[model samples]
Target: MKSTVEQLSPTRVRLSVEVPFDELEPDFDRAYKQLAQQINIPGFRRGKAPAKLIEARVGRDAVLSQVVNDALPGKYSEAVTEGGVKALGQPEIDVTKLEYGETFEFTAEVDVRPEIALPAYGDVAVTVDALTVTDEDVEEQLKGLRERFGTLKGVERAVENGDFVTIDLSATVNGEDVEDAKTTGLSHEVGNGQLIDGLDEALVGVKSGETKEFTTTLLAGADAGQEAVVSVTVGSVKERELPEVDDEFAQLASEFDTVDELKADLRERVEQSKKMNQASEIRDNVLEKLLELTEIPVPEKVVQAQADEQIHEVVHQLNHDDDLLAKALEAQGTTREEFESQARESAEKQVRVQLLLDAIADAEDVSVDQGELQEHILFQAQRYGMNPGEFIQQVQQANQLPSLFQEVRRGKGLANVVLEAEVTDSDGNAVDTKAIFEPEGDEADDAEADAAAESDADAESK
Candidate 1:
């Protein structure tokens, strides 16, 4: 057996392989055995027919066809490994020659990873927004805390922003009721705008027991994308009375016993939050700069696959209904052509990023240790609200553990770039990335825990 490679382009290759008849004995033997079990012979029991007898009954060409079909995958893989081709997707295989006592020859064309020229990590530079926590920020945080401890009281006035209201809603399209669009006693915040369009404006001046009618385009359901008349009746209106910012209120709201202590803590939290935002900005800007500086050729097949996956996800979310998908696009004010164009653009960018990061990881000899992979798995599980064991099982079942490992390696490679690059705040001060972007250790763990706790606190405040 022998194989050779031809470089068709920077991101594609063709591998030509030839296997002599002597080298195909194992493939022929397996094919014969498989055929023997499926055929009947006058004097031989099932699975006991001789290879020559089976070949005589089925013809030599049939036997060779079965052998070629069974052996192409392994032979292609061998050719790929021997040629050192980093194929991106499945190969297009073509059998060039096949004779009983001669040689079997085939050619495989596939997309290969392109060679990338990486820039000096230390020479990269980026600037992020300056981290500045102000009195207004602290005051906003305090306001949120007070609102959380506030009590709702029955009010006699019209609906206002920040007031909670119980309402009954119904909609009709073309004078026909939409059963799915009707609900009773639904609680909503007047100014949130989380529900149907024009709802907030309609509720602004409506008093209890008053009915307001407005027109809105139904986003989903059978009447999706249809203009409907929606009627909302205010069942009750209640205003939230915030607790005063006093020592007693502080004691009731937090572990702190005094308002002064609470405010000080809030200020500290605002600063920490600003720093996290700064770190995120730096990471994004650094990657952008790296992408701008590097030239990477993306494989077309990989980009297509990514785009197809994106489309599949969207379709799956729409329950594989094209009508629902069209309605969703209409709701978002985008057309199918625009959506496909954006999806392709996103897929190209994603492929470029992955290729660049993978090259960097290889050049830097970045590796993912068990501990780092476990930490990543744990973080993902928590993010998706899955138990760690269950998430691991799912990942294993899907054969995505290798992809996960690559993700972690790419992350580490980017972190290394962040550590080596020259990063500065908008004010020209050197940003302290060590506290936020540093590699995992005890200090990093502590910082992560603190950030998680602060994030939970922020969510609770909301």
Candidate 2:
């Protein structure tokens, strides 16, 4: 067997392979055995017929066809290995020559990873928003905590914003009642705007036992995109009475015994959350900078696949109803064309990022150990709300373990880039990225334990 490569483009190649007849003996034998089990012979027992006898019965053409079909995959793989081709997707195979007693030749065209000239990781620089916690931030957190501990009490007054109310809602489309849009005793916050449009405005200033009618276009259901007259009856109005900001309130709301202590804890939490946001900003900016510095040739097929997948998911979520999809786009102030264009652009960027990160992983020799892979599997399982054992089985069945491994490797590669890059805050001060990226001792131990448990679960399932 011999193979040579032709570079059709930076991101694609064609492999030309030729295999002599002598090299296909094993394939021929396997094909003959398979055929012998399926074809009957007058004198020989089932599956016991000789290859020559089977060939004579089935004709030489039939035997050659079976052998060729059985030999292509292995031959293609061998050619790919020998040529050091990093094939992306399936190859387009073309059999150029095939003769019984002569040579077999074929050509395969495939997408491949292009050779990328990467910028120095150390030279990459990005600026992120400075981590700042102000009195307003602490006050906001305190307000949230207070709201959580507040008690709702009946108020004999007109409905107001920030008040909770129980209401009965009914809707009609073109003077016909919409059964699915009618409900009673639904509790809603007046200012939340969680229900239909114009609902908040209708509820505001309405007294108890008062009903207000408003017209708005329905965004979902069978009557989607149709104008509906909705009538809301306020059953009761209530206000949240917040506990005073005192030591007694602090003890009731939190573990802290003093209000001052609670405020301090809330401030610390706000600071920590801001730092997390800063780390995220740094990651995004660093990636953007890397993309700006590197030249990654996106494979068209890969980008198309990604875009198709996104569109498929959107359609699936919309129950494959084109009308519903259109209504959704209209509600978002976009059209189908705009959505597709955005999807394509997003897909191209995503493909470029994947390719760039893969190159970085290779350059850094980034590897995912069993523990790290298990940890990632566990995280994904939790995210998707699946049992670890079940998730492992599903991934294994789908043959997605390699993809998962690549994801982890790419993540590590990005982390390496972030570690090496120079990241500073908007105020021109160097940010302490290590504090956000590096796990502390306890967290590391917990992560290891989770990984071990995930591995054990997977082994049990197997």
Q: Could you give candidate 2's per-residue lDDT for residues 1-462 as a string of tens digits? A: 999999999989999999999998998888888888898899889899998898899999888888888889999999999999988878899999988998989999999999999999889999988788999999999889999999999999999999999999999999999999999999999989899999998888999999999999888887877889999999989999988899999999989999999999999999877865676567677778988999889778877888888999999988999999888788777899999998898888877877887898899898778877888888879968999999999999999899778777776677778778898888999876666666678556434334323332232122
Residue 440, candidate 1: Cα error in Å is: 8.4
Q: List the residue pairs that clash in candidate 1.
A: none
TM-score for each model: 0.93, 0.90
For candidate 1, write residues 75-170 as lDDT tens digits: 999999999999998899999999898899999999999999999988899998988888899999999998898899999999998899999999
Cα deviation of 375 in candidate 1 (Å)?
0.9
For candidate 1, report its TM-score. Answer: 0.93
Question: Model 2: which residue pairs collide?
Answer: none
